[model samples]
Target: MLSSLIFLLGLPLALVAEPPTCTPLIPVTFDNATIPRLLGHWIYITGASKYGPHLAELKELKHAVFDLFPGSHEDELNVTEIMRMNETCVTRNTSKIQVFWHNSTLVHADDQVTSMAELIQSDKDLLILKHFNNNFPGLSLSARTPNVSKERLEEFKTHLHCLGFTEDEVFFTSEKDACPLPGEKTGEGSTEPQPE
Candidate 1:
């Protein structure tokens, strides 16, 4: 009887373990040649899956339909894109996508990320993007991938310079570990596949 009580008491402690903290990957610059490929549609999962919403969007891409979550809005907001052109060129990249707010929604999305003023200096493999915002914690939704290339990334650097963003203002994440998949949500308005 004493052993049973001990086991029951210890079970609660074991179950109270803290969840693993995300190893936040730093942000990279536009010079990374792989940036363009990473800019387009990507399979993203958060907390548990980095590719959750991303994979579903990919399946839709094969059907030639690109859909952004929460639909469209007419207000200023932030967005992220994971573009893909060829299977082999499925590299990871990040861009500070923006949308203008109007009537409580975003009307248009902007790809002018001002942070990446300098060229990428490392030869890493993965890319990570974190939106720096102080008001209204932004939703890390998927973005409509941009059709950028090597020349395009270079061109973008000048564009950022024109926009007045300096080199040090930008940041890059280390290219280690597997790119995570978007996790599955289990409540109303969740991105899980529902019955037809």
Candidate 2:
């Protein structure tokens, strides 16, 4: 009878889901990310995330490009993201990002929700960003150029492993044609043909 009772009590414990694990390295913000230097274009090289809006779907993403511009407010930036879907369709999104420097780190916010990312390392050519939320840990590598060199890619992979991510969880992206210039009609919602 005691054995049966213990088994019954263990059933609920087995059903309870365990919390997700995260890397120990905290996100570090760069103090030198000036507005002018951050502006212009950047291409996505690779990224890994366990949870987010489209974490799984992003694995299939072919290409992504970002264009940063000055915002109306001095502390804000206008960000445009062009993402290629399945090598056929491209999607464009725009958001206003508010940034603040605090505790020697940079915090980014959109619509009042804040996300912190550490600038693990960066230079004139490449930028490494690492973010760890309770259940949403992510790492991304970007470059000024569309195509990054193999050596650079290998360095990024090393950083990924250092952040507790496995090779299978990470995916790389390529650069296609540059995103259309601002306000030239993206046909965002319609079935119109996208630019090649």
Candidate 3:
């Protein structure tokens, strides 16, 4: 019981991470060269939005994980997401088509361009996307996996602040409550199945 209490006490400290510092974010174009680096599992670290409704929705979301699989077509990608919201696990699959024009990332769902974003190049493991979309207007920082560095998280928050979002508007997600993919067994770690 003492160990468990100690673990709980440390959890909040772990989340605070390092202080925010400007991480020189360089916008990178979405292309074949950058595609491979992005094709993998990404854990939603945290996001800050000026949109009120977006924050309300994010408050219900405890955790979310996304798997980006290269689609059969060159311009498309198969996206698998599992998120735990309101104490329920929700899963979604979609084919997203991305097109870049002059450094802007245009994202399409169901064959329609729904939102556009800014893709800043980080290390192979870190992905920083600055979105000004109508639906979820925010700067979101995601990682290739759950073990994200505190420095990276702080850097992302700095960028979010630079984008005009306050610290209170940020939504932080936890990996301890990860949702499972369809057909995945309970008590199993995150997995990726082969494309059919």
Q: How far is candidate 3 from the true structure (C-alpha RMSD, Å)?
A: 10.7
What's the lDDT for candidate 1?
0.29
lDDT (tens digit, per residue) of candidate 2 on 1-196? 9999999999888778443343354444535555566788888888897766446656667777777788887677787666666645554444665656564334555442455666664566666766656657777888898777887777667667766778888988755433444456655542322543
Over 55-80, each residue of candidate 1 has an lDDT whose tens digit, in order, gives 24333331111223332332212243
Residues 1-196 of candidate 3 have per-residue lDDT tens digits of: 9999999999999779754556566788656687777788899888776556556657887888888888877666778777887667766676474756556574746432354567788888887776666665677778887888887777777787766678778888987777666776767554433332
TM-score of each: 0.25, 0.66, 0.73
Full-model lDDT, candidate 2: 0.65
Q: Tell me the deviation in Å of residue 96 in model 1.
A: 9.6
Return the candidate ranking by lDDT, descending.
Answer: 3, 2, 1
Q: How close is candidate 2 to the true structure, as a TM-score?
A: 0.66
- CA shift of 40, model 3, Å: 1.6
Q: In terms of lDDT, which candidate is strongest?
A: 3
